[model samples]
Target: MCQKNCRGDCDCESQPMGGGQRGTKCDVRILLVGEPGVGKTSLILSLVGEEFPEDVPPRAEEITIPADVTPEKVPTHIVDFSNQEQSAEELSEEILKSNVICIVYSVVDDDTIDRITDYWLPLIRRVLGEEHSTPVVLVGNKVDLVEYSSLELILPIMNQNQEVETCVECSAKTLKNISELFYYAQKAVLHPTGPLYVPHERELTDKCKQALTRVFRICDFNNDGALNDFELDRFQQKCFNTPLEPQALQDLKALVSRQLPEGVREKEGDPKQGGLTLAGFLFLHKLFIQRGRHETTWTILRKFGYDDSLYLSREYLFPKIRVPAGTTTELTEKGHNFLKMLFEKHDLDKDEALCPNELEQLFSVCPVVPWGPELIYTVATNERRFLTKSGYLAMWTLTAALDVTKVMEYFAYLGFMSVTNAESQLDAVTVTRDKQLDLQLKQTMRNVFHCRIIGPQGAGKTSFLQGFLGRTAQETDEIPRAHLPRYTISSVPVYSQEKFLVLHEIDIFSMHDVLTPPELHCDVVCLLYDASNSKSFEYIARIYKKYFEKSRVPVLVVASKCDRSPVKQDYSVQPEEFCNLHKLPPPQMFTTTPATAGEPAKVSRDIYIRLATMAAYPNLKRLVHVLQSRPSWIGEYTNQMMELPPEVTAWMKVGLGAAAVTVMGLLLMRTLKNANTAN
Candidate 1:
């Protein structure tokens, strides 16, 4: 639906790759900034060799840690800044490139600790700005020389500045907390606590609360607005990959109940409807951060597609799905089932249709409703104008057929990846074989077809497209032009199979019959003309001769406004005679006369079925006409004969060879006689 992450501060309509924002850097840039002789290079050397180096260089030569060796599974680049080896300009550049900064100090030297607050901290603030998001960790090295913990002295400094994440005292000689110092640096960049928690307020940040609220709502499978036992179990298993113990789950709920008695919803008259409220959910995350378990909250957020900034990552939302030329996309069976479950969860009235309120609730998790008002007219709906279950799936089918990428994005937004346990939305789509191959094989496995509605002005082109949705002429006319839908689609039944038929009106005539690549390409074309206008047939006749005269795509000549008084066309031949000379089927008739009160809604679906049939078997146009012309008994008998065993069908074809040969012989004789008459 969008090129950028929908919730982030980006132009959702159009954005380049990564969208001008940094997310999940390629490698971890841990820049150590401190005064001279603070053992910054010793820390880097100890991390690489697992022991303190006897003779360390003036500065550690930019060491690189492989992604496999790190805890976060991302390559780490430890950049050491030494005033002796690098200038201030180089240091500033390194600071700009760093993802996270570490301010190292010596535990034995109180002067170095004083320099941390006076010199190093001020330098980073001046370079990266006072309100920058780059996290800073306070490192106290040479703890072996001190008998007391330096963390107590550093605690006050960590609280005074919001940029300081935490303080850790380590010994390079004893290798104490050496690896953890760098691990915390990586964790700070991947899952920063500044955006998620407020230490002073002892609560979750506003942005964190909003992100968790969305996650909780998506996991509310029953739409009860609370996470019950079953929902909690599913959430735990999906986020942490382990089942939640029954007692453990109960104990957790009891803790919430004890803290905030009203958080338990049984007082609202139903125990099942009440479990962990949204406020209680936020409270639990705040508790996690308060208890020094912020990683737990970060884990859940990452599993739900949030990055360090708490925006849904682009990689998680728009996974690549390759669709080759001439191949169309359709929804797989699993995709339909997932949407079915979602619909049922929100259909509170149980009428098998989604009312306006129900639909709004269904899209609560999405940033915006992906569809518009045209959706109601684009698919089948109930008499009350609500979207039926069939209409819901049909709308999705149309979207997947036309804009497959859009459908995939909305799938991620709707929690399809998490709820269905699928890696990406590509699993929900099936790309059909090329249309050319389908024609060469004399069959197709596709269930969707696109038909272009090409015609002149005043030919009722818009009315014709909307008529396929069962809308009448008067109802469509009442709607303003701006609100009128440009396209309409619905499913049509062809014998035993169902195919989705899409009708898109083309305004090529508005440009004086100028055609583009889009206007001339489609699975089928509907050449519509007004039967009451003498000049209407001539316009379509010229179009057919100019464009589709020799193309393989199927064409259907439609005579609209049949209910009006008929008029002769200003053309060489009438519609039927023109079609017959070209070996095409006779022009089909169409009308959109208003219905009487209390009458059932009805429109001509057979026309759409014919279009889909032609698209399905593009090379069998003449055979399709023959089948349509045959009586019901003959068509039924043909179907039964085709259903026999392959061996039996082969023998049946052999038995009919003599009659076929006789028909061909008579056709040859008639052609020869006609040629003789012409001479």
Candidate 2:
């Protein structure tokens, strides 16, 4: 594909295709269409020979211009159309395939020039459709035969048709404007004026404005609504591969200011806060198009990942990714770091959570905020129901695991690649190894774990899931619980790394209700019950005996609403005894009540961490069995040590430290008293 026949390496792997990383046209096809006797053949020959040809064929063989010879570093194909040799069907096929068509007419022949509008233009349109985007370049050949310029007659035709990009008058005999003619043809394909500008309006098109606006915001690193000298220089270097000199930068500022006074502003206290405002940025690009330099604007647009249609390319938003079954998607360390930076920067109130206003500001770069009101109840938030830092990361983590493609798209909309200087959002995401492989290795490196909470009615399961986000029962009750989300995800630190635990509240109306296989399929199971309800324990006890009798999936019995008075179960074996017999951990007590306002909530993380830890380490039951096989005294001591809640251990340390200090104080007092007696 890279030879004379090709004239280009468009099929090369490095070249970006449509909507890819660097948006660009790979090759240009220039097809010359005209009446039989126009100098269409002569123009092609003159461009190759640099001289008028004495003999012209009915049609010239198709020519391929090498990329090095073209002005735009793009290979070009030039084809000549003949009415005698090519049928109308063949001409239409060429019109469909060509990027730009050159309609050649004779400068001295009135009839031939008239046929341009009456015949060629309509012909091309009929083939490509009336609203086709393929550009048309009008060429007037045999200019030496006319003493006067023919542009006067061609001017009205151009004004009347939006498809005509430009008209060039040249003499194929004298080679006058011969090279200029084909250069315009190449320009028609490379940087057409229709999409970027409107000649009559003398302004950038609305679509062009939007694409540039996105580029400007991405370059505005400080979110100051302006591009300072540093940002401007970076933008220049990024798009053009060259930075501007100091004087050039000043000249640009002056140019925008001269055109529109408000285009550039001065911030009194902060010079960096003021540079090229959004208005100025738009004005500069508009000015470039007005001056016939739309290629410059197109360059900036493509560099920032906009295709010809002014939409982000697929390759830019959803880079190549594969997640095999039983595998999961997760954010990489860089992704986590970028999100942390965004949270810290946007938390203007510094309450460690984003209020609605702050959340809007953070997503201002995106076209629309992707997450909606349901996000409030799906993740952990502060007392005001605003998303907290952990909640923010948890939302992202949950998205990455569930719909990773959307994560990539939002990353693109959020300017992840631009801000991180990465090639793609792939650096921010990763596909974890399959769970089957993880099980074989007896260890998993996944940062997300799922726990399905199955409990009878009135077991406080709804409140339990909400508590994962630190929401109290009262807070949950503040609003109608009609469609309250059943899933609540929040970050739980397991030893060293932060892991996201997704609590799915499974509604079980009765103890004997059937549990489906998919319902039981999870990393861990939570048998939640109300500590105040005597019969709550029995519902889960029968559930455990029926469904998860000998399954490898770890199960934890959680006694929720522990803030209420304790009650005994009316089952064959009580909760603690049942756990011991099954080699499972003892029933854990949980409550979000104490977390309400002035109450201690140190133990709130205990149950969540245990659930997540069990999910992470599914072989914990085997470890318990090994411990039970050891000496009874050793087993008892190990169980006691492991079962102690972190809050209890902290209080034990505090009491012991206080006792030691009191003994030292007594010694100090005795020494003082003895010294005083001696005196």
Candidate 3:
């Protein structure tokens, strides 16, 4: 029944083929096995070279085909055992060494395909052991002999067994789908979706154990050997980008409890002692990996109280309020009392008001109400001075009566949520203790433009920083002599707003282990060279080519000590020529001198200004926001309220009623406006 197009000899003699660069090579071993006369040798030859031999003789040797998918060529070794008279022990050893197993069966022989499930699969399972994770592909050779529909019948049965990764039908003689069969074989080995073995209660692999240990260490931030509720929430946010909801958190705790040993579970009965131990963490992750269920991990995270939205309901924040089933006035009174209690908790000094810092701390702990400082100032402040209990009550009531969108608009007006606002607020705060200003500046200026200064030793790089800081070149105390990099911070005005300019100065000669990828997350790079030393300029070029040639960040070239350069024999190239040669913009030429010497000789502030202007402000601003607004203990108490029973609490009913009224009022207003326009 062979097709008319079927041509080419089956050359059974083992022929070696090679291509690609010579070096350390990655080897992918493929073992092609089947019943006798399954054309396993023909498939390998067709894939190795699209040439189909007129007659492929039975071969016992291995065929090595070089695959040049990347810079490093991957050599694929295919061994055919169809015609080899090897013993079962020798065949098992061969199968054990393969990365991928290809089970081939001829289309013409229906019994050969049936024998695959009954004989070959069980043999592979016995040889590989149940634990080894090797990829297997079922390939049906000589597709031209029958219609594809006949082959389709067996495909589903093979897929349902889940023993093989995929099934592909091809004609070895016609060279049809031969290449695709090998490509899939390589893919199966390179990118497997899940682990091979499903472990029982007591079984786990070393690699799985190592992965669990790493995750446990990352989650256990304080080295406490266990993850508390807060730590678990933090881990969820880091991994899943959202904290678990209230019920999900409890479910995860229960799941961990079941996985723990009898002694561990007994001790976990106490609420305070209820957290995951190293064993429990490892066991839970192993279960998830074995089941191949990512949703289970996400479910556990959500239950830990990770939420995408920032806002929460008022009732969720304050559960103690008892709304009288009487009138709106009584409801307002109960809400006022709740606010009074909340304000007193935050007003640590009992001064009848909260400061900006205290207010920030209060919001950090409470469910986010979206009540910005401006609205709080208008409602909570008495005589525009302090946020009193009455102010807090009014603000809460007003927010409850409005829609979430309107509440957000009011919150946005406060402006303290931004890096610039936070910086300005910190600057305005009175420093009560010595060195507090330095700490405040460091904490507030989180969004900074990192400028790395690189130059040869004694190239006046340190002197340039000192000059930029309004110090003189002769300020010996300010100049650092350490071989390590020196860091300095300066507040520079950018776009009419202040931004921190952090400079890191590295000694070019001693930068072997210092130039890490993380250290290079800079906004600007400054290459400094002494005008009198030509070698300094050459070193700068080398550094530039090594690190900054493909960098997206701006690079500034500064030629220092222009005043000290020899007019006759200076080896430094002209700024124009250097710029043209390096394909860089024009360089800034400057000279630094002692403060007492002259005002005109100092380094210019314009250079720092230019660096700041070139910074990616939008990205830096977003980074600052993320760093500042990471999940905190603020609003964590809302989780406690969510655990309460579904019965409508008086406070919750009141809040819901208020929200419904607000929505109805907005709808009524829109309807009236529409009617008036129609009239």
User: On lDDT, who's better, 2 or 3?
Assistant: 2
Tens digit per residue, CA lDDT, model 2, 1-679? 5311223445644544232322256678899988878889998998889898899888989998898987787778899999889988998889888989999998888898899889989988898899998889999988788788889899889878888988899988899998788788888877787888766677778888888888887787766677998888888887787888879988999999998888897779976566999999999988887777777887777766776667776667778898876777899999999888778767887899999999998887678987877788988777778898888998998888778999899898877776787888999999988776776676898889989998989898888887777667777776466558877898887777878898888877886888886677678899988889888888888888898987768898888888889888878888899999986777877876454477655336667877888788776543432322334654565567567898986786677568757865775566445434433
- Cα lDDT tens digits for candidate 3, 188-254: 5543322322223335445344434544543554444677666677666655557867577667778
Q: Give the per-residue lDDT digits (tens) of candidate 1, residues 54-112.
A: 99899988888998988878778899999998999999999888888999999988899
Off by over 4 Å in 1: 1-27, 37-79, 106-114, 129-131, 141-160, 171-176, 266-274, 508-512, 593-601, 629-679
lDDT of each: 0.82, 0.80, 0.55
Among all windows of 10 consecutive residues in model 3, the one with the lowest summed lDDT is 15-24
Candidate 2: list runs displaced more than 4 Å.
Answer: 1-24, 269-273, 344-352, 436-444, 456-458, 480-483, 509-521, 530-547, 561-574, 594-603, 622-679
* Candidate 3, superposed: residue stretches over 4 Å from native: 1-25, 67-73, 194-679
Candidate 3 displacement at residue 276 in angstroms: 30
Model 3 scores a TM of 0.29
RMSD of each: 7.9, 10.1, 26.5
Ranking by lDDT: 1, 2, 3
Worst 10 residues of 1 by lDDT: 14-23
